[model samples]
Target: MSQAPQTAQQPVILTGDRPTGPLHLGHFVGSLRSRVELQHTHRQHVLLADTQAMTDNAHDPDKVRRNVLEVALDYLAVGIDPALTTIAVQSHLPALAELTLLYLNFVTVARLERNPTIKEEIHARGFGRDIPAGFLCYPVAQAADITGFKAQVVPVGEDQAPLIEQTNEIVRRINRQVDAELLPEAQALIPEMGRLPGIDGKAKMSKSLGNSIPLSSTADEITHAVKQMYTDPNHLRASDPGTVEGNVVFTYLDVFDPRKEEVEALKDHYRRGGLGDMVVKRRLEEVLQNLLAPIRERRTQLAADPGYVFGILREGTRKSQDITQATLDEVRGALGTFSFDRS
Candidate 1:
């Protein structure tokens, strides 16, 4: 185990999305936008977490396999430059699985059950006592991912901050065992917009729920989704005053509309009276149409060239294998594990 030498190189950031389905506006607002900017300033590794997706989707391995390319397409469509960012598939990295198995020795089952993120997910999925071991131990796997890359920073939603905290805890435990800093502790970089609500006004925006707008939505799809956005139920008439606190339309406006002053003024009008739901919905529709047009176009073009997209993943994963193998060797040495020379 060793501390990384201090250098002027860009800080390394590890962030990723599960390949369960196509990414949506929730993904864009939460992390994708920040990733684009961070690439210029940080050594960014964008992982397509196909293995993590399998923790819950084990029954449908085909679904997990199919969406890896779908998620990668979303990344490329959203301006994630393969030249600036390393976009690798999670299952392709053998060292990560090895690291996960090794790191499990440092964490306990009781603690894993107590993880807030894990707890919430388990309950949400109605797993009860049937939770798969892989599902419960994903935090440990995440710790492996962060440390394998020696990532100094990780971009995630506010709800996921606890996972980063758990990762650091594993890092400290391993350092204490080895009497040296074997891995870097990762800090969570949460987006300012936090989590986006479902168009149906649910607290979570999920593709499975069918309430999220995919990044590749056409203009009509965008408009239709915005039309279904939840606003104040009490404000039935266009002239009636409305509440803005829990209105999903206003929430989307705050995030997507760049005209801050105008949105603020429109909010005031809606709160006082005279603003119709259609009027606000139209504004949101226009804003989203403009935002997603180029992204959808780019995705169509990129989707046409499947070979080019797979080549990017192949190259990135090859580069990642070298880095992770070095880290695994260091970890094995720190634990005094026996190794045979292949040569």
Candidate 2:
């Protein structure tokens, strides 16, 4: 409906994860690490997506709370500096919820069913007979998250392009419905390397599926996880030819290991029937250790200051609150919901 946001002078980026569990290597490789880089260049807003978490995990509030700190730690652990980015709780922002209510009127239930991400997640989570209403309306909430900040750049994995499409559709419909450009049309920033699949060779790394490698994993945990990492499943022995074409191990290398030549070398060796899974797994472990060491150390240091993480969230919430309230006022004014009891 609008021109794809090709470029902006330091465009605002809003992206984040649901605090369903501790963040894993999947998050770091897929998006968090990129957020750290973008914070310096783009106006960044990293949401602690608690409300989204509640959509599916509503029955398990404790699970959500436990992971709230876990997700924040992962954000800090992965170097998303709070000073550079706004990191706030999704539920804490009233404007987001307010906007979600307004946007829901514009989207049909059939349209939400057509949303690819929601469909995939429902099948994956297997919420067949009793899909929660909260879960059903999450895309409207997501539209709220994006437009509440008026973000222009939302980094999405290849699979999540539909979300941007859904968000922009809301933007267009809302502009037409309200006779105002109250919301901004956002573009998907798909990274050069898309989502990394699970170590178990599933489509994606996820907590429910139990394929993720946590950012806080011990060296031994990393070792075991790596040793068991799925390679060419049919390659039974060292002498048997292996395939790296769809192997998750090679997928990790393509995303994490910067030494492309070495990965290619290893791939060649495997296809030639001499490379053992252990050799490649060990190499992956080493690569991950180097990558995660600083994050772990920083997490340890930050853990010492529990108050600090909360302070960051509180401050970010306050700052986000101001802008969101103003936007809500305009939206409410358009809908004739703004009034004061000055009597």
Candidate 3:
């Protein structure tokens, strides 16, 4: 392990999404939008986490495999330039698997069970007494993903802070044993809208809940989703005053609508009792349509060329292996490797 001097080159950033389903508006508000801007200033590596998704979905391997392309399509559609961002498939990076295996030796089962984010997810998924070993150990895989790329920054939601902390802990522990800082400690880059609610007013927008509006959704689909969005139940009539605090429609507008003054004024109108749910829903629909139109167009164009999309992943995976191999070699040297020598 060693502490190298900082270079003039841009810092590395690692961020990714699981290939469980198509990405939605919540993804855009949370991380995708920031990734587009960050690419110009940093070296970004986006991973389609097929292996991570399978931690719990092992029975549905096809789901994870199919969405590798879907998730990549979502990335390309969102203005994440493949030229600027290296998009790799997680399972394709065998070095990450090797790294995970080594790190697991340093971490304990009790610590894995105590991870706040993983605990919350476990309870949410109702894993109960039947939690899979792989699911509980995903944070190790995540550490591999970050350190494999030598990422100094990881863009994620506030809820994922613990995951980064755990990664850093592992890094510190290994560095202390090796007497050098071979791996970089990654920091969380939380977005302004770190988490977005579902259209149905759930705490999170999830594909399983069917509350998400995909980036590739048509105009009609956006309109339909917005139409059913949750608003104040007490404000039954057009003339009744409404609450915006928990209203999903207003929440979407606040995140997506750039017309700050206009949205503020509209909120005031709704609170004062002249605005109807239909009116507010229409505004949100229009705002989202404008935001998603170009993305949908680009997704359509790219989806037509499956070969081109997968080719990007192939190239990215090759590049990712090259970089991660350097780190893996260092790890092997630190931990010692298997060999047969009688020299």
Q: In terms of lDDT, which candidate is strongest?
A: 1
lDDT of 3: 0.90
Off by over 4 Å in 3: 1-8, 339-343
lDDT of 2 at 150: 87
Candidate 1 regions with alpha-carbon error over 4 angstroms? 1-8
Query: What lDDT, from 0 to 1, does candidate 1 have?
Result: 0.92
lDDT of model 2 at position 290: 93
Residue pairs whose backbone atoms clash in candidate 3: none
How do the predictions measure up, each by TM-score? 0.95, 0.91, 0.95
Q: How accurate is candidate 2 locally (lDDT)?
A: 0.85
Error of 2 at 54 (Å): 0.6
After TM-score superposition, what is the CA distance of residue 125 in candidate 3 from its true location, in Å? 1.2
Against the correct fold, how does model 2 do in TM-score? 0.91
Clashing pairs in 2: none
Q: Candidate 2 on 1-343: residue-level lDDT in tens?
A: 2223323466889998888888888888788878878887888888888999999888898988888888898898887777778898888999889899988998999999989998998897899967898998988899889988889999988888898999999899978877887778999999876667887888778777888899988878788888778888799998899999888888888788999999999999999998888888888888988988888888888888989989998998898888777877777777676479321
Candidate 3 per-residue lDDT, tens place, 142-248, comes to: 99999999999998788899999999999999888888888899998888766799999999898899999999899999999999899999999989989999999
List the global CA lDDT of all models.
Answer: 0.92, 0.85, 0.90
